[model samples]
Target: MIPGIIWRVLLIAIALVFAGVQLDREAGKTYPLAASVPEQFRSASQFPMAAMALDSDNPDYTLAEAERLIRRRPLPAEHLRILAQAQFAAGATDESALTIQYAAQRGWREPLAQETMARLAIDAGDMPEAARRYAALFLRRDTQDALLEELGPMVLSEPGGAGRQTLIEIVGGGDRWHNQFLRRGARVMPADAFVEIVSATVANGSRYDCDLLNQLERGLTTRDEAAGEGLKTVIADQCPS
Candidate 1:
């Protein structure tokens, strides 16, 4: 009877050993030998869903959804840029600017964000801010001359004549891009108005460069030959030396 009890105990121990081996083999097969769990997976499972929400077919809906997600998780800088753009699309310029500024402050350094901020500053009538942004952009190594040409007049229009001089200084020479900006500025501004503004700015600042002033005078004259004489007459009367 003792022998029978010992035999039963031995069989039970063997069965347990065999079951342990099977479990170990199953676990080895289920998990890749070199597989590592991702850190993001541990942080939150909702990240992917939040990211996907940004791609909704309707821009407004996507923005709204992203805003909701951002409120919940405070997405990374890239996502924040998207959120800023969404705010811009919703006509919330102030909010968009703030968001983009946050990204910039956080070292995002996205060109699009800088450009958007510059545009926002212009729209907000903050000429100084616009000028600062344009200056920084102009100094960038990768700045596209074509884009600068398109953006120059708009930047110049911010501070009126003073801004025009800055644009001329930045543009320098008869580069095609600079000429394009000059032509665009001329077309958009009335010849008399531009002349008057430039004259006033020149009068106020004694340190103004003669060559730049000459270039502006030439540009104003070439804008519309018919209007040039009239503009000169207006300038002479309104802004006499």
Candidate 2:
């Protein structure tokens, strides 16, 4: 009753006819005798570093190289994205999904990896997962927080969409870290659009603590300082007294 892992190892050994590779237990790695290894796999031996030099954008070549690379050795987790993207390019849906799952379990969340997973999820018609992955990639503290000011106008359009709702919640929250950017957003975004978001958030029953409300009141004042007459009217009507 050999375990599945042992069976896989045995199968791999059999595939290569038990070629002149030995596990150097002291060093904890398998060392292959080059002469006994098949010619096809000889180049794969260089892949620990060579794989990084490979052109990842060429679908045909990348798919083939990545496929062969994974078959011969366990790659570094950061490099697994090349394999995942290649698998998707080759239309190996199930294999790509499994590879992506494996990469996640190993804690690989590089930008390219996130993009690969998102693409695969979209290709598989898993919109929720795709959207979730895409959102996760951008919503991190380092990524989104760095550009919180820039995010305001980007999410201000589409009058009643989820993006607007999210902006509303963010603006009304106690996190002052982005409050200045929120104020900047209100000033830079169109007066009408900014007013609409504020009014709707208040209308929609988004409760803000007194401190945040005070901040918002001060924020809107500056936002109106240079606003046009119409924008000033809208702000005065909706902003706190």
Candidate 3:
């Protein structure tokens, strides 16, 4: 009887071990592991591990190590953006600009990427390109005037504010450079006063109707109260109730 019990126990143990092995194999098939690191860089494994460290909120020395790896290997756009952000956080504006530009040139036209390019252009005194990029993004009609407001100083500092006005007129403001005049009247003028001009044109019924009122309302919330009230008076006087 004792021999039979031992035999049964051994058989069950073998079966359990076989089942566990099969389960592991199935899991491996379902979720394949990453390839083994090549024998090139002495710290090749550290790159991804550093990235994981960034994600895990336990960067420790990983950020410094990741910077070294990036300098050596030059990661792809996704990783490059992370490194750029890190540079930005460290107040290394030039390094951030270069890294972001590399990603942008590589066809990463994300909003953040585009904004970074614009910032780089502004930093390099390339006002025309900065204005062009900002206009292209503004025409999407998604960004807010706060961003334009932030860009005002740079635009005004440019040669005669030419690029800034060009961006404003492109978005639907009328000719004769009255756009800036109107924006000033509305008290919404920024360094790039064209944004205000375009906003006024849209708010004043030159474009779509009540459907755009929501956007106008959001703009009003951020605009000068006096300007907003004046605009409301104009709408009440001009547009039908």
lDDT tens digits, residues 138-222, model 2? 4444444334344333444456655555555555553443444334445455555565555655566544344544555556666
Q: Judging by TM-score, tell me the better candidate of 1 and 3.
A: 3
- lDDT at residue 118 of model 3 (Cα atoms): 79
Please give the range of 10 consecutive residues that has the lowest summed lDDT in model 2.
21-30
| Model 1 pairs in collision | none
Per-residue alpha-carbon lDDT of model 1 for 107-148, expressed as tens digits?
A: 334566667767877788776666556655655546666665
Provide the lDDT at 125 for model 3: 81
The reply for model 1, stretches above 4 Å from the true place, is: 1-55, 58-61, 64-77, 87-98, 104-108, 140-143, 157-241
Each candidate structure's TM-score, on Cα atoms with residue i matched to residue i, is 0.39, 0.36, 0.43
Taken over the whole model, the C-alpha lDDT of each candidate is: 0.56, 0.52, 0.54
Best-to-worst TM-score order: 3, 1, 2
Best by lDDT: 1
On TM-score, the leading prediction is 3
Clashes of each: 0, 0, 1
